[model samples]
Target: MAGKDRQITLRFLAEPADVNFGGKVHGGAVMKWIDLAAYACAAGWSGKYSITVYAGGIRFVEPIHVGNLVEVGAKVIYTGRTSMHIGIDVRAGDPKNAERHLTTHCIVIMVAVDDEGQPTQVPEWVPVTEADIKLRDSALRLMEMRKKIGAEMAAHVTPGG
Candidate 1:
């Protein structure tokens, strides 16, 4: 979490439609949740509209079954011209289990856009706390990895979208 943005907390509940026949929530569903959480974090920091432009490492550590209460937290870690890197941590709080389990973790990059839908520069967000620093460092590393993967994917892109 970014230092000044410590006031951030985004929550969402896992629903039936989010689960697969296997009874576990689908990874794509979780990604959607992360996207929303990251957008909220970026919006909170930018105080304006932000759109996701890139996505970093998305790792699923545990299964989130149906009826689980999913709590996701996102915080801005770094900022560029108009882009902000936000760290997303998703946890599943099951009534059956006494402790919440970490389910998914990812870093989503969002860019503040103008009304015309072009990327626009925004103020940089500073990390104020140790936690924020740690998260930011992790996000930066993940960002590098994502860039490499993106380049690899681009090299294989065909004429089709």
Candidate 2:
């Protein structure tokens, strides 16, 4: 896979319409941005249309102001037969100062799909750099944790409840 296909970054200004009653960009808006970036990264890497299968571990570290410059970065850290694990980082800060800091982070799972929307196989991602290896390991750890969490949650549910 080409190096450029593994990542994507979106930069834009947070609009006033994105603000919440608390006068900061709404959490939902940030989530939308994250989804958009993740999709772009997944599609670029897989060379096929992709859809989000799961998104979790979203942490809003800091409030993003309406006028702040927002950057959402997404990278494909791991791949399954049909799924890509994307690591997304959302950062925002004053546009004038040109300084930015992390505001949110999450992991999104995207599945490549064929024209009929069936899951399609994607090229496997192999980590080459130290950062890439670290992120891939992190994704693997998260996947294991999610499985345990899912089993625990299922144990608590009752039939037809």
Clashes per model (N, Cα, C within 3 A):
0, 0
Q: Per-model C-alpha lDDT, please?
A: 0.80, 0.94
Tens-place lDDT digits, model 2, residues 4-83: 58899999999999999999899999999999999999999998999999999999999999889999999999999999
- Top TM-score: which candidate number? 2
Q: Name the regions of candidate 1 deviating beyond 4 angstroms.
A: 1-7, 95-98, 159-161
lDDT for model 1, please: 0.80
- Clash pairs of candidate 1? none
Clashes counted in candidate 1 amount to 0
Q: For candidate 2, which ten residues in a row score worst on lDDT?
A: 1-10
Please provide, for model 1 over 59-153, each residue's C-alpha lDDT reduced to its tens digit, 9 standing for 90 to 100.
Answer: 89999988887888887778887989887889888766667889898778899888898888877776778988887787777778777888999
Give the range of the ten consecutive residues with the poorest summed lDDT in model 1: 1-10
Q: Model 1 misses residue 149 by how many Å? A: 3.1
